[model samples]
Target: MDLELFLQQLANAISLGSLYALLAIGYTMVYGILRLINFAHGDIFMFGTYMAFYMMTSFLLPWGAAFFIAIILTIAFGVLVEKAAYKPLRNSPRMSIMISAIGASFLIENLAIVVFGGRPKSLPVPDLFNRIIHIGNVSVVSITFITPIITMVALAVLMFIVNKTKTGMAMRAVSKDYEAARLMGIDVNFIITFTFAIGSALAAIGGIMWGLKYPSLLPLMGVMPGLKCFIAAVIGGIGDIRGAVIGGFILGLIEIMLIAVFPELTGYRDAFAFVLLIVILLVKPTGIMGKNIAEKV
Candidate 1:
């Protein structure tokens, strides 16, 4: 490929990777704290985008206000899901919690279809996102640049919260042993709910970005992206934040480059993630940054 084309593809890859990383971080954070996969997370993503869409179209709010409100609502929804679906099953077997998560996912998707209607709706793109930028022979949307910067800033803030604060210490302790942390005076339930709130916020931001990039919305839109981000989390080492970012970038690059190099394989783009997942699981089931842990008896 020519240099310009390659650069264009690279920009697309980075943008897509940023979205994946944002979503994957949510997955990693929840798993890190609760040892539970929030399968409903992608639906939360869909909910956020729909909320923003309605805020803009139905409520006639500006993009900034719409996005802010949508994120807040999404966070609340996520916490509710935690309390209603996962919290009660926490002391139960892991399998039971997993099933609950799946059921929650289905419930949200069906509800979305009923509420948002099954028809695909177009997101009204803001001028800022739609504006085109030129660099030599390559041109790309402004969102391409904005996405990575947003991802980096969000990651930095999250790292600070996770590494440099008392809350972080409590979170780490809880992750190590919930009962032990509770014994040590940490509010374990609060920590889990806080983690969900953060995860939901990220999902909301990612969903907004996804809508700007793709513009078309469907009830099932989050399904593929959600699964792909989950794979990204697993590939990066599910509980490690840095690993999730690395895995997301790697997945994005491979998918974009594969399609660019061989246009015929465009149809198989989704398959690439699954193939990578299988390879990672076989080669390093614990993931690149994941340390093997003894199963709790």
Candidate 2:
């Protein structure tokens, strides 16, 4: 590919990667603490998009305020999901929790269809995000450039919260050993809830970005991206935060570059993530950053 084409695709990859990174972080965080894959997470992402859409259209709010409200509401919804769907099953078999997660995902999607309607809604683009910037032979939107910076800042904040805060310590302890953490007087339930809140908040950020980039929202919109982000989490090391970011970038770059170089493969673009997932699983089940642990059983 020519330098200009490469640059343009690079910009696209970076923006797309930012969204995946945000979503993947949520997946990894929840898995780290609960050892359960929250299948409903993608639905939370879908809700974020719809929340932002209604806030802008129905509430007549500005993009900034609407986006903020969407994130807050999305966080609350996530926490509520955990409390209602997963909490009661905490002491049950692991399969029960997983099944509940799947059931909750479907429930959210169906509810979204009923409430948000079956038709797709157009996402309102703020004037600022629509501006284009030119660099040499490459031109891209302002949001394209801004997204990576936002992702980096968010990552820094997440790292600080995970590494430096007292809650972070509790989270680490719980992830390491829930029973042990409880024995040490850590509020395991509160930590788990907090993790869900943070993860759902990240999903909201990603959903907002996804709506902006795609400009179309539907109840099923989160399904594909949600699965892709899960694949990214697995590829990067399922429970490792930093690894998820790396995996997101890898997935984004590969997808963009494949479509750019071979237009024919555009039809199969989504399959590439699954193909990558399979390869990663076959070659290194633990992922790049995940360490294999020996079970006592």
Candidate 3:
């Protein structure tokens, strides 16, 4: 209602949107290549968070080093999951692959519960990241303000890697037609593995940032962001990189605005997305930027 409140809400939306965008990129990239929804992605995100926790607490590593290590381990976990679970069923019925993904998700979540315990842990935050910067009517912490910029830069780098490099070409080819790509002498397995690696790495960045922003670390923390990011990918037209970013921002704005206007609906935040999802599916199942893909049956 007031300018100050509006500005604060806007800041919150942008910060929240950045995290969504990072998470959505991974979803969109994997979906683009494999045409499979990795249900375990959320758990992979949780893995990243735990990796960060171990690096910081056990290894006594600096934040930057811990973050990098988390990325590496999380990426490895994702690749291993693919090799063990999804890859075996790559040639099987689509439903089989989907089920494998679901199984993997369950395995990771249960394992996390066993390892991290049922109790929630608070993420260790450095003092530097705790400072708030007040500019004009908008009051956002330095970490909050800077996070979106970092996320956007990361997205830009990802776009360059996916669109401008040789590997990028191979990825595009696989996404377009895997069999055709293989026939063209493209290393299908390598490209698929690379895709998973990058996707998982990006998810790690998001997980770390999410932990930094919210300061809560748990096995289930990824569930909400993972689900929300999936919605973002769908809204932006699944498989489209730019679409995912746009969708993330839009979804973030909607959620923040709804919560700001009607605090009571805070309980309905998840419901809000499904409602919007259903409406979008009814109106444009292909999403805002999704193309009508016709397959020769």
Q: Per-residue alpha-carbon lDDT of model 1 for 1-297, expressed as tens digits?
A: 999999999999999999999999999999999888889999999999999999999999999999999999999999999999999999999999999999999999999999899999988999999999999979999999999999999999999999999998898999899989999999999999999999999999999999999999999899999999999999999999999998898889999999999999999999999999999999999888888977686
Per-model TM-score, in order, reads 0.99, 0.98, 0.97
Report the lDDT of model 2 for residue 52.
Answer: 93
Clashes of each: 0, 0, 0
**Which of candidates 1 and 2 is the stronger one according to lDDT?**
1
Top candidate (lDDT): 1
Candidate 2, residues 161-240: lDDT per residue as tens digits?
Answer: 99999999999999898889999999999999999999999999889888888998999999999999999999999999
* Candidate 3 C-alpha lDDT tens digits along 1-297: 788998898889998888898888899999999998888888898899889988999999998898899999999999999999988898888889998988888888888889899887877987667787888866788778877997889889999998899999999999999889999999999999999999899889889888888887888888878888999999999999888888888898999999999998999888887788888899988788899876533
Candidate 3 has an lDDT of 0.88
Residue pairs clashing in model 2 are none
Which of candidates 1 and 3 is the stronger one according to TM-score? 1
lDDT of each: 0.95, 0.92, 0.88
Ranking by TM-score: 1, 2, 3
TM-score of candidate 1 relative to the true fold:
0.99
Ranked by lDDT from best down, the candidates are 1, 2, 3
Q: Which sections of candidate 1 miss by over 4 Å?
A: none
